[model samples]
Target: MGTNVTVSLKALLLAGLVVIALAVAYLVGDSRGTPAEAASGGGETGSSAKRSVTVGGTGEVTAVPDQLGFSLEVRIIRPDLQDSLDESGAAMDRVLAELADHGVTEKDVRTTGLSTEPIYDRSRNAPTTLRGYRVVQRAQVLVPKLEDGGAAIAAAVRSGGTAVRVDGIALSVADPEALLAEAREAAVDEARAKAEEYAAAGGQELGEVLTLREVSPTYAGEESWSEASLSRSYASDMALPIQAGEQELAVQVEVVWRLAD
Candidate 1:
């Protein structure tokens, strides 16, 4: 009976050990499957880690201006401020009326600058009293038809609008925003091409676009197109014929791409 009892106890213990071993094996197998399932599932794959490289460059395109700007200024000088103002007003009215007759609407005619100053004779050392006042009024005209710019100015001057000035002439896109968008896309393409070139030449992958900038374009008409460039010259040198040349609008950009390993 003692032997039989010992034998039964040993059998029970062995069965428990077997159950524990089987549980451990099942747990191990389940845990190992999780990593394999995750790898094959919605998680990012190693192929996505391939590095992309980029380079940078700049490009510029020049075009002529299709529009011209005109400034018709009328100046009157007299010993009396009111007198000069009256004379100037009459001349300005005639000039503006003439412009309107030529299809220049009120919307197109914009007041640019005006001034009234006491005329002083500073030739002598002694301070001279105000002899008269000089009154001047100016308005700007933007002509979509550049060929008509000079003709318009001539008409204004002949209409008694003296001291006409050509403020500036510029070239621009009909839709500047659209032009800028196109230019930006071109710049990005150029940058990407550069990156690919670098990569082909044994560089690492492209990381990110670190910096990007677009340069402001200026109208460089005959010379540089500043607001004062043409007018100041025309005032000092009126001999130049009125010829509204083509204007240009431009956009520039710079991009920097980080290098990846």
Candidate 2:
């Protein structure tokens, strides 16, 4: 009987040991997470251990415009539609010839608008009456020679006579690459200065650049001609005065630098 009791106690102790081992194994597996969680980066990967600073910089360049753009129109009103068209066509031909003589190439002149509409004379008490047929022909002109812009406009007006209408003119830079390069250099220099100041304030140093990117530039304050400011009738023989004023071009950039130890 004593031997049997001892054997039974050993069996029970072995069973209890097996149970404790299984419980410990299950707890460890649960703490380690599931298979799916392990595949999808469940734990702290510590990828963002490196510190960096991002800063934005801006630069501007003021340059004189080198190109001129303007529009001209010829309008004639007559009792007959054919007469209106013929008169306006002849006036436009004169204007084009004058422009060609002044250095405007054929490619630089484009017929933008042409129409013939009936003119209505409206009164407060009377019914609207058809006055005449109005014909209009418009052309967009670009002059590469900035100095001769006023002369070209005056010649065109003189050739077209009193029927000619001069619209607003806008000045622009023909090639902006050189100015853009200068502005970009300025922007990068400004960014570096800002980064250095920030690094000093943080009690650290700037390391090599991690990333450099250019932001799309916005030219809001740049000066340009407005229709309301320059649009008018051209009936006089006096020369039109043109000024190729300075315009502002801007560039912006975003830069990231790693923090040094």
Please write out the lDDT profile of model 1 over residues 52-130, one tens digit for every residue. 3334454444455555556567788899898998998898888777656555677777998889998887756687777
Off by more than 4 A, model 2: 1-48, 124-126, 208-211, 216-238
Off by over 4 Å in 1: 1-56, 122-129, 161-173, 207-211, 222-248
TM-score per candidate: 0.61, 0.69
**Candidate that would win on TM-score:** 2
Least accurate stretch of 10 residues (summed lDDT) in model 1?
A: 47-56
Cα lDDT of model 2 by residue, 1-261, tens digit: 999999999999999999999999999988876665564345322442356788988989988887777888999999889999999999998988988887899898989999989999999999999899999998899988877777788888778877887765777787888988899999999999999999999888899999999987644332344332232324454546677767888999999998775
Per-model root-mean-square deviation over C-alphas? 12.8, 8.8
How does candidate 1 fare on TM-score?
0.61
Alpha-carbon lDDT, every model: 0.63, 0.80
